[model samples]
Target chain A: MEEQVLIAGFGGQGVLSLGKILCFAGMKKDYNVSWLPSYGPEVRGGTANCQVIVSDQEIASPMFEASTAMLIFNEPSLHKFEEWARPGSAILLNASLIASPLTRQDVRAYYVPASELAEQAGSLQCLNIVMLGAYVAACHTVDEETVQAVLTETFGAKGEAVLQMNLRALDLGKTYIQTQK
Target chain B: MAKILMKGAEAIAEAAIEAGCQAYFGYPITPQNEVPEYFAKRMPKLGRTFLQAESELASINMVYGAASAGVRVMTSSSSPGIALMQEGISYLAASRLPCVIANFMRGGPGLGGIQPSQADYFQATRGGGNGDYYLVVYAPATLQEMCDLTKEAFDVAEQYRLPVMILADGTLGQMMEPVELGNYVPRTKADMTWAATGFQGGKPRSIINSLYIQPEELEERCLAMFDTYREIQAHEIRVEEFHVEGAQLIVGAYGTMARIVKSVIMQLDQAGGPKVGLVRPITLWPFPQEAFAKAAAQESVQAVLSVEMSMGQMVEDIRLAVNGRKPVSFFGRTGGMIPTAKEVREQILALCNGGKE
Candidate 1:
């Protein structure tokens, strides 16, 4: 199965790193994956988005016409990428930041209060990771084990405390998704 | 072996280091700044030299100096920055220095937006620097190919004794994908007999100069360079063909644009509309005319479409290669805008309808 995901938020919301972590998770599973970040002026303080494609086959263009899944962390990201979702695609939104509901009826969407959950879990910086947890739980693109392994690999240098906090943040998001359904 | 996920820019940097390139000199430029950043963090650790030159000119000249001393050296920049280094590039070409230059091209004309663009086609394939010279240009379509070609680039540069260029737009430089990193075998530079090390003992002094004031002597040097270019053209032409069997139309593209075309070809294959194929030129300078000719020679092939990210820069070469055997048409998106697969397919379908311009 192929999943084209767009993870979007403001510049400092860890959008790019979340996409990279997703790519690493997919790679650990031996899937063909690509992560393309919006570089240049758009990434300064404005809405920054990254397109992540994970497939069993070769990924052609990193930029997809319509994404299979989207994780929006803020209102701007929702407005920017909501229309680009493919029919029946899954869109996970941060309900804490985005007050609007989905307009499109064709796709499945989950309102995961990612920012509030991450903030409660310890820090608001793990907001993207929380959204990533929701997407992974919904799509099952990669196993939670794979995500945790990559998280350890990525955050290992930051020491045990930071790594455990982020891991807890992920589990908190995953638990929230499970409770919702 | 398992592959590792890497960004395109960082992959190129790693590939260069793995190829035993010892020195990197470049100014920071958008869309390609990661190249120097990667080297800056890694090269010092590896004991290799990494210098962020004050400007592109100084960078290229530093590359020239390191290369003249028989060290594997490289410098990378985007469009406007590369334009600044053209004079130094010309001198490097004239002096027969072996070095690699990576151009992660962005939108062009002058100081255009820092987005992906293949608009530097002419500036890259045809010498931007004055006089008779050619940079052996390699345009990689995938990040894997980007790493592989970069490793091969250093070898080709030293073998041909000329400056080689990796002609990538910002798309290839910024994107991340799976890359099977190649092993690094330490390069021994013992065979650099002509390098300007020193004239110790009774050894004769070696002079490296591009300036020959006498017209005839300069012409002679150019003719000799042309001989090398001809040899390179004969042996170094590389192209990748996809779905060419019984194809009624051929889509010609390079770099990231070629990947987009490949997706279009896959779409047509699934729809079973027309027999379509792609001819991806890996080596742009040695323009694979033979491959184009062979693809055009297919009995079912009706026309060839040259798809680029520039305003018909490579179409001229496509027309020359097709040589009126088939109607050669052009489709492109300029100024860092990339044409989607759907839009490109529409163009291809229109071309197949009547094989018109």
Candidate 2:
């Protein structure tokens, strides 16, 4: 039950936000989880990332030896983490991201047109959701229901519409992955 | 008691609030910025004093002013910032002001990258700021220890009329885990008495300056401070020993890196005393020197391995603590390239086999 997830992309692509969401969602689901971000200059408009781990046992170190799955919102991340993935590891690539599909196929690779799908969903801001949906599909550590409950709790009193839209994006992702499978 | 996951920097800020700290002076630095942020958002709402100074120099001086006013005060920074605060730190040491300073160490010499590093070992245990006074320094590897030790640092500061430090790394600051928020019994504001509250009728005016006219008097004061330091070393040397009995190797570590070493000890034990042991120095300043020395004296101990985010800072102390009685070895991954327990085990095994490493 040791699931290591990496979310990587450009700085403003909500990489930090997505990682936090998943880390917190795991906590809500009562799992031992941790979120470690790339600190220092690795954050300003350049490559940014965070490692989120959910395990039934105590996390020895907040680092991952083999990232079980990744949500790459850009080409660099795809190229960077692709070499490190183990067999059967998932690489959910956003075709609309900075990088396209040049990744080698020794693992489960999915081409998620997440950016365009997000724009069509009436909110480009929800691209993170599309990628997160891929993560959910690949990892299945937490259900969509749990994610929604966390969103409702996180969005506070004024988050009703946000909660709905985010859920929509998530479902859109589920449908997108479902067709591929 | 309850449980919650807390970062070392966040715990320092929260502990400041609980310790009745009237002011928190600080500047932004990696791995340690959470302390200021936590205070910035919460202190104002709580009606406590909070200031984000322009530089570490300004922050430390602000701490000086706040402390002089007979109020609980705190400031935190990384190695560079601590270097900037050295002058003021020396003054605080000399004046015997009670305050807490947290060092979220990153790799360094100059403008080091933002990652966990214990390279400040010499600077910390030996007094980086300079002067003869000793600070009661605490090195917490866990979030729980960070919070608990922070509050305890304040108490030690006031009790001994000295400065205390929470020496942690960025890993402890940016990581999240389940932590217990148990029954928090904050120390009462009235519990501490050596403050600079203005003198009342008939009460003599209290001075908090570090100036003394007589050289002999100053010397006496210095001697007394050393005596206090020795007493603290004797009474407060805390260490967490793991898998030591009948163990072949002992890895000495502290702070965030120590947790990884803890995991390594478990792995070694499972690998048949790959018979490895651990000595966690929770108090980096006082250091668990006596414990390690005693352990090293045993023939089965073989060699001591020092693991840290720095190249090899704490290793020097380990060697000295062992006093050449045992062969001390070092292995590290700095610049944020921390190694796993397996790597450490490989290094230790190489050493014990008398092979090139």
Candidate 3:
């Protein structure tokens, strides 16, 4: 289906990690995937972004302007991606920071307070996991179970403290969207 | 064969692993640092020597040390670092030591930027190191080809007793893709009969250096080396074509830029795909002349579009290949900005109809 996802935000906000997580998960699900990141003078404490392509066939080009989905973590991200999104694409926004309302009615828009939910769930860096959760829920490209397994494989060996908080983050994120959030 | 997703740098390292290379030497540089880092982790496990030298010069010298010992060895770097190693490469060439080097080139003239570029074309093909020498150059677009050709590079280096290189750009070094590692071909130090490991049996100490005071003898050596290069040009040319049959425009690009141009081909296809064609040169040196020249003369092809990262490095080669029967046009984006297929197709359409897309 030629699916493309772009995750963008401030450098410290974990946008690159989110893109990597999504790409890694999609790859494990038997899809052709590529993850490209922008890091340098342009992203020096400023805006950092990554483009992830997950396709059912060989991805022809890694660079695509109008992607099918975007997980925006901050204000700059929304400004960057909002213009380029296609007609029926999905825009997932982190409402805690992006105070503006999504004015476009052509695409499906969801505002999830990712940072607030992560903080409420007792971890700050879990914002990326929460966004991943909302993305999985919105896209359904990879099952939640496979994501948890791959997440462990990618991040589990670090330590018990990280393992514990990330697990909680994942669980809270999945449940929040499925129920109240 | 085991299929694993790897970055171009990592894939080159894995390819070295499968080839059973004796030692890998390198210093960290952007775009190609991952190759050395990857080798550091894996070489120890395989019992091969991996040295992170103090500088590119030291790394190339270390390659000299290992190659003189007649065990497969290699060093990798980007343009600036490769420039630092030029003297070492010249020494290796003069002494006739066989090894492979990887040049994952970034933008340059000085410390330009960390963007992919083909600016190193003249340096690579023209033997930037010294007098009358050519390192059989291999350029890879796909991660699989990087791995596959690394093995071939080692073989060719040893078989002809000269250096080999896999010339890539920042995109080829940093980008990740699926790659299949080929069957392991184990190499051991015992395989080299003429290696200088402190002369067992005391059969006259072998000296390896590039110094030749005798002018006539030096001329003979130069002729001998050229003979080897001629054989390489005759037998080692490799290239690929895309939708080239019966097309009005021919686009020539290499490495990562070629991959991007393919997308432009598909985009053109979607817009009723341009009656345009592409020639992707897998080898920048031993320049693939036959295929390009044969295609140029066909009445089907009206003009040749030379698309490259730099202003006009490959364009010169295209002009040389066509021999000026048809006008070869250039469309390039430099300092690491990749050209989109749409952008290139627009150029092709412009020349095709006497107007721009």
What is the DockQ score of candidate 3, to 2 decimals? 0.48
Model 2 ranges with Cα > 4 A deviation: A98-105, A156-158, B1-8, B186-193, B267-273, B335-337, B340-343
Specify the highest-TM-score model's number. 1
The DockQ of predicted model 1 stands at: 0.78
In the range B1-357, model 2's lDDT, one tens digit per residue, is 444546556766776687667789999988787889999999999888889999999999888877776677899998888989988988998988888998888878788778778788878788877668678889987777787788777777776778888888888888766665543565444344456676666565667778889999999989988888888888887788877665677789888787787766666566764677788899987988887887787778888889888789889878989998878888898776677767876787786676554
Report the C-alpha displacement of residue B107, candidate 1, in angstroms. Answer: 0.4
- Candidate 1 scores a C-alpha RMSD against the true structure in Å of 1.9
How good is the docking of model 3, by CAPRI class?
acceptable
lDDT values, one for every candidate = 0.89, 0.79, 0.83
Task: Write candidate 3's Cα lDDT for A1-181 as tens digits.
Answer: 7778888888878887777677777777878887777734655469988888888977766777687988899997798779878889988888888999887889988788889888876678888888888877777777898888878987789887786677677776667667744
Best by DockQ: 1
Segments in model 3 whose C-alpha atoms lie over 4 Å from true places = A41-46, A102-105, A156-168, A171-181, B182-191, B202-205
- Scored against the native two-chain complex, candidate 2 gets a DockQ of 0.48
DockQ of each: 0.78, 0.48, 0.48
Runs of candidate 1 exceeding 4 Å displacement? B184-191, B355-357
B89-206 per-residue lDDT for model 3 (tens digits): 9899888889999998888878888878888888888888879898888888777778888888888887778889899888778767767777645333234555677867776687
